[model samples]
Target: MDLTTRCLFLLSCLCMLLAIDLDAVEPSYYVDTSSTSDVIDYKDPCKAAAFLGDIALDEEDLRMFKVDRIVNVARQTVQTVNRTDPVTGSSTNEAGQSSVVPNRRGLRRWKRAATSRPERVWPEGVIPYVISGNFSGSQRAIFRQAMRHWEKHTCVTFIERTQEESYIVFTYRPCGCCSYVGRRGGGPQAISIGKNCDKFGIVVHELGHVIGFWHEHTRPDRDDHVSIIRDNIQQGQEYNFLKMEPGEVDSMGEVYDFDSIMHYARNTFSRGIFLDTILPRYDVNGVRPPIGQRTRLSKGDITQARKLYKCSRCGDSLQDSSGNFSSPGFPNGYSAYMHCIWRISVTPGEKIILNFTSMDLYRSHLCWYDHVEIRDGYWRKAPLKGRFCGDKVPEPIISTDSRLWIEFRSSSNWVGKGFSAVYEAICGGEVKRDNGQIQSPNYPDDYRPNKVCVWKITVAQGFHVGLTFQSFEIERHDSCAYDYLEVRDGNTENSPLLGRFCGYDKPDDIKTSSNQLWMKFVSDGSVNKAGFAANFFKEMDECSKPDNGRCEQRCVNTLGSYKCACDPGYELASDKRSCEAACGGFITKLNGSITSPGWPREYPPNKNCIWQLVAPTQYPHHPAVRRFRDRGQRCVQV
Candidate 1:
């Protein structure tokens, strides 16, 4: 009972407390209670048990999953998964019955195979995909953008199919959204991008499965990262929470990533509202990392693919106003088997100008082997500006949008010093907003000579584009043939000309007939000035509204204003905002004159004008005998 004995006892008690603390934090995984002898069935994966509500795993990939168990899950479909809605908000059922489901913040919106087959990896990281004809133009655009999302971040590239035997065909089916994991050998493999699956993130997630990515939560080491709530999981969906063994699939030597786009949402396959089927074991200060991020690829997801495909980590998203980038190992020979994508985004009102300073790569007829491709927008499928190879440097490429996407690819056989380029944000770009402002390049300062800038403004449907000049100063011209501002009523230059203005006088406000408006400003080589500034806004429909422009009779909505009109015998009132009776009446005043309705402008058609002259009937004054001009009309009087 001395000091040594007491200290030793206290140390033993502390050790016991530490052991209990460790056990409290340890993660608990799903325990299999079903018999091991349970037979696994193989069938059309898309139609079989592999179709877990929204995900469809192929038979080969399905085998890697352990299915002989009852895992707890619940029905907590986030408001985001109402099936009919792609956005995250309250939605209604087929009977128009709505429920207010809580929104899963940051939950913006997959599976893979085993036995790594080289064929599973697209040849040369180039994939060919076909969009079904049944898809609308906007749906097709969404598919392309989904494909481009991967292309913009990884070495993987997508091309429209052209008689390729093995390719991915995107189809629309109302049978839930799903995609096969990896390439299905032989003919075209199908990926269903069905109703409510047109979202960018959802489509991207499906494409990830096509690119041979397994769900992050299914990793062999996922037991140490997440715990599946079997009671909350949907019945018959336990296979979704099963983990793959170590030998079945490779994790590319990466840690379990909770934010991977391939990871499922916390509430996925839940049986009731607010129930989470998957919960993370680790948290930073008690806040778990969000899963199922459909916005973009996580760092781990990108790294794993790059490592598996031997793709280079060279590209970056450049958002600076001005910056420079080059191919991997620029000025020095770049390694073979390289695929890189660089996206440049600037302010909304500015455009990007990319100029290559040097170029060197293996040249081919189509520049197919090794080349640098430039797109006019951030999407890889955007209009191709050029595909350059060899020693010659390409011309400056200007973007129609505020962004640009560039890619450099090299084959395993050839190597080169590669290319270097710089991008600058300049004036002019597309505008699609309710209201915004646009200014000339270096406005308030003398603009550069021999410059051409185009501005396109698009408002909401059923709304017209209205533009007003805030300030105006361009080179003087008689016919606006020199430096001037040209405006069009439509989205293209071929549309009807609205006005061409120059000199000091500011032109009047302009309103388009439709939702689109286009403008171009040109400066000659001889002269330059402070240029001009303008504001654009959406013009609402005045006549289509309930009040009918407050007009008594008919209301006609023009480009910038509304006018009131009366019946055949009536004309517009003096107030200009009302309709009044007018076609024919008695002329009692001697000093008054007679004319057609709506003079100065075109007169209304199918109208008969009749007037009775009764000049007091007392002093007719020789019946006002005077010469009357025919005025290009024959008078019939009796």
Candidate 2:
């Protein structure tokens, strides 16, 4: 080879050596704290949380979650120590080699969780990610593999960030591997996957932290499943072993699983191989396999994550004969314009009994707002049970039909904690008998706040259902913004509303126009009073003959009585048997557009025109103009 060609090769080798030397000299992770101790550095997502001092979980907030361990930084610096390879009989010097991460690695104890404190489930199970430019090609590939592992076992999908408001940025910094719990809305989260931290299992563990699962050993029930050895832990890391309170963390009903990928290794945080930290409890059943297997996700890990994120089963869909489901962001505000529909079915003959754990939604006195509507069957044409809003949970709803299709909807303006409900198909409840009485949930006692309940009373065919509230006392409000009861005729909500009674007064005895009657009661977030109780009995509200009110367009029957009525846009003629429409007049549903009769063509030279508009009783008719610009046409007030 020529000398010049050989020189170029040597120069390239020199550059490579220089890069390695620089990497070896990098400083260990360190933090400069402004306070002396336990000041709760909670405000910084970039820093570990200082000890919050024995803040045990309280009974009232069992649904709330909080992590006790911080992304702590051990206060030491890495120094080289001599190591001998037993197999090769060779000597080498390695920096901070130990069973657990060296005390100097600083960033410690993976923390990934968001207390119902303040979190919302990600939409569509997608998580956007970012990678710092400094990581080498090999390191970047490890990050991708970790993410793909999660995608393979679960519905979670991770993509590169592009103008996203929140994302995880893979950064190669001084801190040991660590990631902020769940979403911290203020900005992007930085996960430190530093040098030597890219092992498959370690990378997967850090990614788990980003998705919101706490370390398996930290679970409150860990004691029943595993024994924690305290003496083996590194110094000043007592906070790292703190266990969560019962219910403070949810495993999505998964059994204690030592095989979970979220489980810490037996020697995690230990000073050396002789010291181990986690041991699975032994039982009559048998001993279990070792934990901290970084190979892939365990069954419990995948199931819990799927349940927490609202993917498919677990809690999202209820196909079982008896089951329960909650809003998408349970224990948190459901997002705006959110729509979730659930179908519940029972055996060929049984009916469904739905009970609410809690319900809080945006409120509007006019009913022009967020609501959860229930139908007797799966189609849109199926009868609507009732429309409910406000902060209150509704009373228990019973369906005479064997199936129920429930849909939850939220408008764009505001949102609340939404609702949580459970339904079980009953073999023989009160409604199954066709003639029975119904009571408010927890009758004779103050109803729980934020509740919604519905009961469908059905009588045999050819007979009508009569209902009366025996005892009633709901929070008094002119519009019932906080709590109220609605009764409807027939099985659907489209059935005519008989009465929307609230206040302290008992409603008068009423009878249904058909064989079925639906009763729905809702309560707000505050001020729940003793609710009402109603009795159901079958009777006929039928007519012997049909008569168009002396001869008009139509006639209606009201249990033993009849009345005549004319369709909209027409009025009874002088003879009462005929009808006439005013010039340019027509009738339309509440949601429709109106235009001049002449349309896009020219009108006759001399003709006077007038029109009338009408709406359902719940929403009084109002003149609408200005800002109604969908048609690109001109309109004027008559």
Candidate 3:
């Protein structure tokens, strides 16, 4: 039991303590570079080594050797035992960690388990995050702003803390390398130039990935809806990892959303072989359902997360009867009704004014109704009341309940074409309709009239009626046919009728008459030519009134008198005698004044000036006054 026994017992106890120490320490995470027993081509060793170098160790001191005189000397022997690459005889050193080499097959198998597991969501506590690269205060401000926006919308809370209890941690390191974003075991981390990090939206985007969202462009079924050019995708590269394992399913049964905020900005192929690209394709144009830097968690993302981590108190139990999450309805709630007749109620004796802008005459229609009765037929014309061709038109006024119906029709060929209509109500008494030849004082000579008829009429109080108009047919020709009728009680001035009609026609005839109006007839001393044919009535051919042959020669009809013109040489005297000549040709002296040689100068003596004949050669040559002068001239004969 002396020296031999004591030494053996001490050795056993030391061996036990060493085994216990190894068991207590957590295994350091490492990437496996292994070769298979059966020969198979693999990633290049150098490339693998470079990728390994990219792996950043959180605890760098753990790999650094302590510089001490005694320990340094003792470590020299063990340090000389070089770990060489299996394929190359190169000694492995700290830099060799960046070298790519196949790992033993057994080691690769052990890593497979850890890599296959999906990342766990951060517990209900603060998450620790790290920021790589130097960041200025402004850059951090931007990052905080984005984080705040995310926090407000989502359940996650990001706290910047330096301790392990802190959910998120940030570290700044200046590396010429472009900023890269990724999630460590705890929270999201980013690397970039300080100023650039502040300016770029990459922080929010990377945080999205940290929260388990995928890239929008990498949606598995996205190709079905969007055509992605093969050249845009990286060859032999996986841009995103599936949230669930290859065949696993979440509670919602939804696959990962490529458009998820967590996805990489560029496609797998876009980064090139080195998993790096000088410039990312920021053109979101062709990307359907456009994805952008500020893009937040989509509905699918929220729904999945919510299902997985539901609120215990106010979870799915709350019934959303208001349809808060329902998709929006058609045409929006503001102007959904297109052609339905609307019953508008107004104060008694109130006048309604309907106005439209830039009337699309071809595709617009208007109709009026009162007390559920369809008053005026649907009218297809430019807006009557509003500015047209830079001219103002009188707005129609509705005074009675009978005039309640108003219709608007729009026929723009564009699928989503629409125009604005404004209505104003004027409250007074009944409206007045003047009968003294309703005319437009401001009518322009070159105005082309619209086909629709707009009338200004008065109505008594208690007037109510239905108003409606049909929608214009959609066709290649732009259709903008809509009608809005408003009735108001005010004395608005008459608007100009922009077109001309040659034949003697009355305004009432155009509005109430069932007769069809034809274009003006032109005569060149021969047969007359008819104007354009326009339908005036349901069953009428022409609108012109008929007269006998003698009436055509010049027959006048007065309320109390009638007359007919005689032959060219005949004339009528003051005594009402119809004869060949009223006075003889000889001259006569009257009251000391010389009379004309051809006729009798009758009546007051002062009324007749001394007359004489003047030759046509003495006519005034002044163009200005001559233009107004009569054909013949007489000289005074005193």
Candidate 4:
């Protein structure tokens, strides 16, 4: 067999043994890196013109321009058969892969050759690009997938070019995959996607360069994390491993991330097939970290990108039951001319309690400059609880419902340490005290929609609950259906109803028939209004008024109502109200005797007799009493 046939057969066999599907293998696997063999060099007018070194440019400019060179397929193995087009000096390999010659006219503008320079970022993290018609349908899909991978993790966005002055042009020229670092001011910068460069990760890596990321190994602090093996590195490619000065690159306060997609594999730029140009160091735990992961953006990479673009740590949506949030750059004076908003939401039927731990901001009488505004609702238009500034921390703010909106604004003139705050979800409970106050969630302020809160006020038995409304305003409804406060006479919802109050009308005093009172506030998923507030206290004794209990004799007051009692010589009648003459009396002396009504004669029918015997000491003496009746009636002793 010929050398190519033998190579293919061996590779197919190896794939089968490894359980790898060769058909599913990405074209990046076909990269050729052998320096001994000749590879096709696609000559282009742009590359040649720049290589000629225009007479207008001086020595240093040319050197820097040379360092800004772009390449396709950064690091890969070499194994290919090249078929060159003699006329154009351009050729495709056995896998139909070719190299792209970047448009070098724009390279003259880039001066930082070895630094991880923060090149001009896309405005607002919005990038405009145009995909060349030369790409096949599937190839276009790969490009989109890579773009989406970056967008999914970071705040960066990619859109088709419109009339923007600066945009990216995705071109297919049979060149290796490559892209310029950061956005170029030129009219149309090109990101070349060659034949074998259509792999998802390869495209993603190239785009990382476009998004202003340097190789991970070039980080200033990389030496502490990775060790470079100079002996294994290719002789002329040593510059690729050089580290940037500490001040030149920004790590965004993140530690070294070995899994960054921008990182090179251990074998990158190796002098031999089996040589490794880079080796990871043991961590504090004596464990080595894996490197060169082209699967997705690393946490460090995402953080750095976000920091460069100022996309996060500015505003967020908080939904935890309890959490804390602060202004951007809190405790370290915030940036000038900044605006940030935070929306906090907890479980429904609950309320939010926000507490400011610290506050330091530019002081203004009207708080028109740098200040933080808090609202009882979830939007900008929500009722503003307060707008605070200066060194004084604001009072604790409680929401009427489960959501709160907080905003921070800073003027271009002054800034301070900003503020810090924490929040938690709070809601209904049982109030069993003698007298206290009860109000709707976030009463005075507008209540939130779609919430139900219950409050059970229970005092000592026999004491009726008295509630008086100080202020009342709810979502107006004729039937008190949308949003209303329902008061029941007992502790449970099934108790007898006192009243359902709603709208702007204030309810009269509520006095429960029993000591327990049940209150439930219900709000639908619609409009909201300021809820009601009321104070509850123990009402006066029900039997305090003269003859209030309708008793024919003495009256006694209980917790919630009244009762009747008979005098010494009288008995309680069957009607339970009238008092009748009785044969019993309280005997305070040493001894006493009692008899039935109309004693010596036959006692009246159905007459009740009673007597009380008492002694001054702890031990009391017992007295005997007898009752006499007519025929068939028996005499009983007490």
Candidate 2: segments with Cα more than 4 A from true spot: 1-46, 51-72, 75-120, 283-285, 314-638
Q: What lDDT score belongs to each candidate, Candidate 1 first?
A: 0.65, 0.57, 0.28, 0.62
TM-score per candidate, chains pooled: 0.44, 0.36, 0.27, 0.37
The lDDT leader among the candidates is: 1
Error of 3 at 591 (Å): 99
How displaced is residue 309 in candidate 4, in Å?
1.5
Which 10 successive residues of model 4 have the least lDDT summed?
A: 10-19
Better of 1 and 2 by lDDT: 1
C-alpha lDDT (0 to 100) for residue 19 of candidate 1:
12
Compared with the true structure, what per-residue lDDT tens digits does model 4 show for residues 1-638? 23211111121111111112222212111111222111213222123211111011112223333233222233322332254323223334343444322123332221121223334577767787776546654565567668767765666767555467777777765335555566655466667777787888888887877776657776768888899998898744554675655444456557777878888888887889789889888664566777777778778777777666666456766755678988888787789888887777554346789999999999987998888998886556679899999999888998875568788889856767889999987656577776655656544346667878898888888778988675677888889878899999999989999999887767887889888889998898899876766657676564566655676656765433456766554557777777755543334444344444544545566544444444555444543324333465354433
Candidate 2 lDDT over 437-471, as tens digits, reads: 45454343566677676666678888778775546
Task: Please report how far candidate 2 places residue 601 from its true position, in Å.
Answer: 84
RMSD (Å) of each candidate, 1 decimal:
27.0, 30.7, 42.9, 35.0
Candidate 1 segments whose C-alpha is farther than 4 A from its true place? 1-45, 58-115, 316-324, 327-354, 358-419, 423-638
